[model samples]
Target: MLQIIQRKRMNLTLPRNLHDSLLKHAVFLSVCLPETVRDTFLVDPAVILIVVGVVMFFITFCGCIGALRENIRLLKTVKFSFNTLLFAFLSLMLPQTRSALEKFARKAIVHYRDDLDLQNLMDYIQKEFKCCGWNSYTDWSWNLYFNCTRENPSTERCAVPYSCCTPVPGETVINTMCGFGVQTQKYLDANKSIYPVGCADRAVMWIETHLLLVGALTLGLALPQVRKPRHTCRVCMGGRTSRRHQKGLTACWRSRAPTE
Candidate 1:
């Protein structure tokens, strides 16, 4: 009876082609899974940071050696410098690092904004982060404006509306309504609805910090190169002149010395 039952079960087993088809379908479904699931489950910011740091380290190391060796070739030096700056900037400005910095800034902004004391808030930020002036307040004000006004805008999209400064709020209102500006108040309204105040603040902070760092690094690295003129052989300096005159050049003994 047991043998008979086993034989019946074996007979009901799926054919090889059917089994393979089912497996292929399963794999197809797996392959088409949402990207977010993979991002959420497999992505590691720390690993990315480490990889970027390593690349930057290598570039800086190579650049230092090339510079020390006095490799006067502009192409080599420029290439090295560019790679060094790119990798270094990546290490500092990666999305994860920016997000962390933004989170800190957002928390600070929210805590202070909630107090409704702009002066105190500015003072606190100035003391803590060494950031001062009306720009900071204006940024917060814009943040509030966008947050209060928008409906379901993306954080990335909200910045567009805040970048412009119209003489009157009505102008801004009109501009937004007409979609005349890079960012409209409608977008801002949308972003505000979708995200919390803290998220916007954080995103802004990240962008500001990373941009400042990138600007500083770019200036620091590029200014010296720009200020210094490239050294070249006399022949190279003459450029087209050398090419044109090459066939007509007299031998040193054939040319007479100039009279004083």
Candidate 2:
């Protein structure tokens, strides 16, 4: 009777613990995998901005030094070093679900208007980049206030943003109404009235015009560290230091140690 009771207790306890352990393991796998992959590959917009800034600084420093010295060897070295990165960027394929730049711009504007920061960013980009809407002034047609539809009774109908207009000479205050009703006009008339060309076209033209200059700048950046070196990369991955660079660090520490 005593042996029978002991055996029954053991059987019940083992299954209960095993069931709990399996449940925990299942939860861990489900919660962690997708988050880990997302964080590893697709970075946040703010992080992207920071990375771009750092690269620009690096390019300027390398280009200035190499150009001032007129060092052919250094320039050639940098050019060869950056060839892989340049190729990667040029070959990068981003998703184009919307299929057209005009449609994409309209979708972005309408979808993100409620997000104040995004709205301000779009306005600033248009003003500072000397650009209007995405594909052209007509892209504002997607906006509720600017849609050309007569059935819509908004006061801002058939209008584009003021940033689309050319500024007057010595103008201190901006004329906010300059681009109002410009969208209703034909391209030939609007060309004289306001900026008729789309921001997308402007951006494309800029890229095409400066493609060679961009290539030269990219090569002049001299970031040969971007190469596939396991030791150096590991150091860079964690706060820009590694064991390989720890030489003399130990010496400094020893020198600081108490001595007789």
* TM values, all candidates: 0.27, 0.50
- The best candidate by TM-score is 2
Q: Estimate, for each residue in 158-234, the C-alpha lDDT of model 1 and write its tens digit.
A: 33222232224445343333212223344354333222123344445767879988899998999886524332233
Per-candidate RMSD, Å: 18.8, 21.5
Q: Tell me the whole-model lDDT of each prediction, alpha carbons only.
A: 0.45, 0.65
- TM-score between candidate 1 and the true structure: 0.27
**Residue 212 displacement (Å), model 1:** 6.9
Q: What are the per-residue Cα lDDT tens digits for candidate 2 across 157-220? A: 7888776788788999998788888888888888876777777878778878899998988887
**Model 1 off-target regions past 4 Å?**
1-42, 71-195, 198-201, 205-225, 230-260
Q: What is the lDDT of candidate 2?
A: 0.65
